[model samples]
Target: MFGCIAAGRLVQTNLQQVDVNKYVFELSDPQSINHLVVFLLGTIPFEPGYAATVHLLWPNKDWQLLGGLSNEKPSAIFRIGGGKNNIMMNQPTATLGISIEPIETVQQLLSTLSSGVMKSGGSNLQHAVSMTEVGQMASRVIENLFNYVTSFAVQDLPMNGIALGEVTERGYLPVKAFQTWYNNLSRKLANDPNYLSSEKSA
Candidate 1:
């Protein structure tokens, strides 16, 4: 059995509007699902810390957290049972996954930013100006946020199979793990001006 749940929250604006959508899905089967595959399609904006949790109902009950793919399209696969004779017996046994697809929200956000900049005549300017300064500051904030999240993900990623299995049992790493690593990495990077300059140049 496979089912999907979708929900969204709408935010209204004078110039543009946004809707944040979240999808939660589940799959269950009496006959063991051996080679299961999931594909996340489209260019939907993904939420930070989002993950897909898969549980196996078989001889050895275990759970796995699907990691994100670096490509534009993301997919994951898992092997459940070992032998053909092994069957999934547990009733209502399910694997749950959540996908955060922020489609309209991102478009609206970009539109709003563009409109604001155009209205302020920022686009007309050719050189560094006050508006350029503000734009650079905003870009830095966004870049910092992206770097922080990526660093956290890298540090929190399981170093070994045992650690990965532990994450499957625990659902996800604690928020503190991400926060601690993010802060530490951010501080280290901030303190290294040469590294920062090189990164910026790159």
Candidate 2:
């Protein structure tokens, strides 16, 4: 069924076994979306398209949907907030939470493409073109706002003082020290003849 799913509206129906693994709800009013809450009447995984509608209650009357799990085993409740349409005139900023799969998939796809190119022969013009296409795709995927947040959250935390190990035995340091080391490494990389030549050819 194709129809518009409003940001602040609730939609309920009964289906014996709904497998929403790949199903997605495309919202017509993207900007007006405040929050989406989903309630499942049976045990089910969080489907991609299922969402809940936000209802404004009292005092905190500008009712923002925080996060919650349904009281019943078969039921699931989700709260969505933060979109152009969800903002109130006199409220402090409300954060909209959205969980998106990371761009690791994009990176994995690029890696596969790179492997194919390597197998095909790096000197092949076709392989070069494919590599370029993959790179462009990667850049576009990384630029997506949701992907950016997911990447940041999933990335490994950087170790402290790893850069200053040569100067200090502790192998940990502050931001300024790391910046200096990073700058030096950047300069070296920038001046490397092979790296420059490869970049130019690409």
- Quick one: best TM-score, which candidate? 1
Q: What is the lDDT of residue 169 in candidate 1?
A: 26
Query: How much is the lDDT of residue 127 in candidate 1?
Result: 15
Q: How well does each candidate superpose onto the true structure, as a TM-score?
A: 0.27, 0.20
Q: What are the Cα lDDT values of the candidates? A: 0.34, 0.31
In model 2, how large is the Cα lDDT of residue 53? Answer: 23
Residue 186, model 1: lDDT of: 58
Model 1 clashing residue pairs (backbone):
none
Q: For model 2, how big is the CA root-mean-square deviation?
A: 19.0
**Alpha carbon lDDT at 78, candidate 1:** 36
Per-residue lDDT of 77-118 in model 2, one digit per residue for the tens? 222443434344344333322222223322232234335342
Candidate 1 global TM-score: 0.27
What lDDT score goes with residue 120 in model 1? 19
The Cα error of candidate 1 at residue 129, in Å, is: 49
